[model samples]
Each structure stands twice: as structure tokens, then as C-alpha cells.
Target: MINSHQALSDTVISNGYCVGCGACAVPEQSPFKILMDSYGQYRAHMDDSPVFGRTDSSYEELCPFSSSAPNEDDIAKQYYAETCEHHPQAGYYKGVYVGHVAEDEFRTRGSSGGMGTWVLHELLDKKRVDYVIHVRSETADKDLNNIPFKYQVSRTLDEVRLGGKSRYYPIELSQVLKTVRDQPGRYAVVGVPCFIKSVRLLQAQDPILAERIKYCVGLVCGHLKSAHYAESLAWQMGIPPSELEAIDFRIKDPSQPANRYSTYAKGPSGEKVVPTNNLFGADWGAGTFKYKACDFCDDVFAETADVVLGDAWLPEYVQDSDGTNVVITRNSDIQLLIENARNDGRLALDDLSIEKAVQSQDAGLRHRKISIGYRLHCEKEANAWVPTKRTKPSRTLNPRHEMKRQRLRTELRDLSHKSFLVAKKTGDLSVYTTAMTPVYNRYLIQKRSFLRRTYFLVKKTLKAMIGR
Candidate 1:
């Protein structure tokens, strides 16, 4: 046990595979402590005392990044192998759906169609779960420097509603998972793909958690942004990280497309609302403030979860400003709940074909499943102890263009963190932007159409000749 603990500290933590899910810190009297670092991302720090054994979990078993830990396939096979249809991208699905909550302001209030909270609310209403453990704005905390969002226990529909929208901020499960263990009651947890995988890993070993955590509701993620992501966006809104009070990552715009949402930030003097695209780190693909662990992760649909919900980015659905949800259900109960809601006119939905479901997150799929091997190959070339992933290491990339793009993404990810720290130190946001501009410009250039590239090249040559 101690060796496994030490191994986790040395490999996953040291090698940058840790996503700070806090699963390792959940056990009582644990040697691991979850702390937010200077970069504004949560991480587990190991202490000297090898204290543990209260539950059937270990660092090796609980961490989603641990090579020894059971992969999503291993965990999902236990809960769903017998019943669900499996896909490389969708994981296990009993059904696929696309639409929004029609009954209330759920669609209007939420980041997407509001199926995330609607599902959590149904669990509470049906008495299926005594509490919904989800992320909420840190309004309850009096501390001025608190992270804007936190994992909290929501016991009522109203409480659940308070945590409605998607929070791209970093949050950990150590505190809330401990609450589940200390108190005895059914609970539903809301989190992204990797976090859900960690929960499934922990639940496999911890019977207490397995029994109490009634449902694992998942959010489809492009990738997780660090706490710095919030700071960067807020800072761009004239609310610097020091005075950063609160932020809303997704504010729907009816005039524009549903995907064309806005972000709102508040500070001491005032508040500002800006179109998300206007923000520096708004490009989800560029992956600013992204944890390196996210690049290695292949599960985009939250496969091991009971049900995974995310935006229906397909052309047919993107026009609706209210937003639509692409839901993949592995658990029969979740499928039944959503189906009943649709039948009763509570939810406006239609059966989404599996291919369309995959199409919604096309770019994310390419990044995770297609290009992941090159990332792993890079890790090996550096002789780093990379986490064992479903996607094996390979560099057999086609077209050469994709390889360059992947490399640029990795550069964007690493530089974003390092440059942000420099910016924070100097109190100049331009430090980060200056460092990122050329690389980001290169990334954009790589994505340019061939005709556009030719036009630019011709323009450059003509200008050079004119100068000569």
C-alpha cells in the first residue's frame, strides 16, 4: 500500500498526469492533501505519514491517472457490460437523445439545455438520491479569495438550481466525497469525463462510497480548464484575479447561436459581460490553462458514468439559442427518467442517432482519439512515466498538417501555464499574451485554407519584391 502511494506521488504527480480529482485524499486520515497551487489548479500533495486503510481504496486504485488503476473500460464493464451497447467514443449507451428542457427556465438558465440540473433535480424529487453533490458558485464562502466555484452538497431542488450552469473551473472531490462517507445517504455526483472516471475508480474499491453514491452523472467535456482559465477570462473583463469575486462561464445569447454564449465576471467596483469569443482563452481547441492530463484522456462522453450530458453541436441543433443536450445513457434508470420526461412534454427531445451524437463533438474526438498517440509518443521520447491510456503510443499521423497542429496545441497548453505565472508575477497580462501570440498565430495559420495560405504567401513575396 505504501509503495503504491509512493509510486503515485512519484509518477502521476511528478509526471503531470494528476487532474486533482481528490479521490486519493478522500479516505479518513489520508496522507494526501488536496491543495490549489499557484497556477490555480488543485493537486494532491503527499505527506510523510503513510496513514490509510479506512476504505478499500489506494492511490494506485483510486487515481484515474494511475497505470495500476482500473481503466474506464474495466470499471464500466462492471456496471454496464451486460446491458449497454458500447462504442469507441460513446462508451456504453442504452439510448442517445438530443433536445432541451421544455418545462421551465432550465433551458434558459443553464449552460446548455439544462438536462444536467434537470436530471439531478429529478433524482432529488424522486427520492432516488438524498443529496446532489455538484459544483456551485462560492457565494456561501465569506472569504474574498475563494475559488469562484466549488463542489457542494445540494439537498433541495432550489439548491440544485443554484448550481445549474456548466462550470469549466477546477474543483476537487476530496471534501465532498468525505462528506458522503461521514454522512450516510444516497448521493448523485456531477462532474466531467475524467472526474467521473475517478469516481468510478474509487467506487470500485470503496463499498461505502459505492453504496452511497447512487448515481454518477457526467458532463461531456472538451477538456478541463485550470482555475487560471477563470482568472484569465475575468482579468480580460477588467476584473483582475486578485479582486476576482465571481464569474459565469456560459451566458446564452438568443440573437446568436447557442454555442455563441457570453461570459460574465464581477469584481469590487463593478461587473462586465463579454462575448466569450472576445475573451483570450475562449477557444476551447487552443486549450489555454488546460491540465496536461486532459490531453491524454480519450473518453469524451464520460463512458463510465450512468448518463453523460453535453451540448448537441450538430448543425440541426446549433441554431437554437436555448441550447440542446446530447445525452448518452448507460444506466436504465437515467434513460427511463429522460424518456418519461420527453413523453410527458417536460423535455423536448428526439432520439439522436449514434452517428449524430458522435458528430456533435467531432473536433474533440479527433484531438483525443486520433491525435492522442502522438502525445503519448512525445512522452515516451522524453522518457517520462506516462499514464497507461486506452490509446497506445504512435506517431503515424497523416497529412503532416495534423501533426504540426497537435504540436502547437501542446505548446499552447504548456506556455499558457508558464506565461500566466509570469503575468501574475509582473501584474501585466501582456506577458502571457506576448508569449502566446506568435504560437497561437502559427496555430491559426496551420488551420488556414490552402487558397488563403497561397494568397498570403503571394502577398508576402510581392511585398518583399516591391521593397527590394
Candidate 2:
């Protein structure tokens, strides 16, 4: 009767703030449906004549972007206030470590040190949870065009093992979450920051899900990319988007640094593998094809998750081609599991100070936490509706140049999505490149000391001429 989507449609959806995590669509009677938009990014579509708030969690309360919804800080504090130490950027934490699974092929098979999959498998092997919900490659079609990967329910160790590797493409949670609701069992979900926060909010609303969902696992995200990111990489490899079948985003090459990875793509003609660095939009810092919501998010570490994992992008660990993981544990139960495995010689872990853990994702934290204000400031200056965020909007919050950097990133993100769509329509990959190259180059220049040097040189010349 309340027409739940009225508020969401007006703000989050209208402003392009929706992240398509699918928590709103999980309710059986919900009006929201998750669908891939023309930009190849999934978005929430709300149906007419739908009621808001099934229980205490109303539409605003449930949607992570809503002003009324509990933010990562609020959610993390609710679950982990007394048990964990809090940081401005990393939320709550019980323990932090850098390590890799020593016993199995997890290190080699995973995009990182294998702890992402290893953590899920540990729970499954111990019967701690009946099922695991994580994204997995659907290898049914080696050349998988329709949907190459999805959020699947894995019950056994083998199934869990099948679900490793980082997927950069867009994925939503509604379908898999619905599966968890239909099937009665203890379930653990793995997602990025906002998705896990969505789960925590949903749990507070629905008793069934709250009881069955035993763990909330998180992946430390720089940001979520649209499907076009995968398509762009494939296109660069001569596999047109139309002919794209399957893609492996993280192919570890031992000769290179752990952070340097390759991408493998297969099409009807043949298969191709290329270093990820060779691709134009491969720069994570550029935020190419990234969801707009990511620009405003402050949570770099998945604060709402019980346990979170990410690549140890530190100097000491980056040399190893085998890869390493930076793990943060908020729950003692998960901490014990890792310690037990290390004690059993199945895992090799080292104590990582909070400072060092934050260092691993230094750039991401600065962007999300510090640069967020510029993004918010930009939106407000245009008189647009933005979700209430933990950090308030202010251009002066960061150093002056950072605002310039944030604006350039904003330009790149918007242009990539729009240009890629044109490319998809015209069947010419250059449409995207033509549109993005200069801006990308400009962004790269902003990252270097070249601009600062040029600025100072020009300033000195102008001062001398004026003095004369």
C-alpha cells in the first residue's frame, strides 16, 4: 500500500546510486527486480503496486544506499562493537594477517593467496555451514556468452573448490539469496563491502534468513566493475563482445610480480591470453566501468563482514608470483579457524599490524575515504540528491589536487560506460577507446609528478615575465 519504491526510485535509482547488490529483491513479495542495464551493469527495477517494508526493515532501511539504512559503521558496530577494535577506514577488526594456504593448490589456483576460497572450504569441510554462497565460473560452455559466472550455492568441498578466482564482472545477489531462502540450511555468503552490509540489514528484517545465514564473508573491493570491463579486455584481445564466450580474469604468471596478472579469453575463433597491464582500462585506480555508487562509498575493507580477504599488495608479499592474502577477522570463531589451520601446518600466516593491513590497500582507502567528499561535493553542487554518507561533502577536505583527480576519475567512469554501450551497438571497439584514451591519459598524467613539474615551470616563467 505504501508503494515502497517511490523513495528508492527517486533517490538511489534516479541518481544512479544503486549498486545492484540485490538485497531488496530477496524478499519473495518484493517489487524490486535486478536486471542488467544497457551499460552492462546490473540495476534494481522496482515494480508498481508493491508494499514497502515487509517487517521492521522498510524499503529505505533495507536498501544500503538509503538515508535511513544502517551504514557499514552502524552495522559493524552492532555486531562487533565489544569484540573488535575500530579504525576510521577499516571498521572493526579482531585480527589481521598476511598469509596463504600451504597445504593445497589453492595458492596457485586462486587469483590471490587462496584464502578467499580456503576460508569458505574450511567452513564446509568442518560442517560449520551446510552451504556456501559465492561467485563461481559456469564452465558448462567453455565459450560462455550468456552468463559466464554466477552466485552459486556450493555444498561440498569439491564444489567450494570449484568456486575460486576473482570475478571482476557484474553479479547480483537476488537469485542466489532466493535459493538460500527456499532451501533450509546454514549458509555463508561472500560479497564485497556493500553486499555484506545488505545481508546484515536483511538479516535484521527477516528471521528465516537471519537464522540460516551463519557467516558473512567479505572481499576487500577497490570497486565493482560492470560487465563491459570483461568485454573491453576481450575486445582488446580481438574477441569481439558478440563472440565472447568465457574469460579468466586472474591468470597468475610466476615470472611477474604477484599483483601483475593476465587475462584469458575464449571465443569461437580461438582463445587468447594477455597480460592485464596491456589492456587500456586495466588500471583499477582509474575506476573504469565502475559503478557510480563506488565513487561515494567509504568502506574499502568489508566492515560488515565477519571475515574479509584481499590480495596482499605490499612490497614484501608482491615479489612472490604465488600470491599472498591480507585477511581481517572480526569474529573470534573465524579467527580460531585460521589459527587452528596454521597450528595444523595447513596455513602459513604472519601477524599483520592494522597499520600494515591498511597499507596494503592504501590507494583504495584514500580514494574511498578521502576522495569521497569531492564526489559528494560535485553531486551537491549540481543540486542532485545523494544518499547520506558517513563522510559529509566538502571539496576542501582533501588536498586541492585530489579534487582534480576525483573529477578526472568521475569523467573516466562515466565516459567508459557510455562509450562502451556505443561500441556494443556499433560493433566497433574503437568507439570506447576513442572516447576513453585521452581522458585515461589525462588521468595517468594526474597520477604522476609531470603535472606538478609543468605547473611549477609555467608559474616561474609567468612570475619572471611579470617582474620584468
Model 2, span 310-381: residue lDDT tens: 989999999998999999999988999999999999999999999899999999998888778778888999
What is the per-residue lDDT of model 1 for residues 1-468, given as tens digits with 9 covering 90 to 100? 357678888999988888999989986667788898888888999887645453334668889888898888888899998998888877888899998899877887788899999999998998899999998877743531235688999888888877788888889999999899889999999999889988888787789999999899999989888889998998988988898887888888888998899988878988888999998868998889999999999989898899999999999989988899998898988888888888899999899888899999998998998899988998899988898899899966865567888889999999999999999999999999999999999988887753476698899999999999
lDDT of each: 0.87, 0.88
Q: Which residue pairs clash within candidate 1?
A: none
Q: On a 0 to 1 TM-score scale, where does candidate 2 land against the true structure? A: 0.93
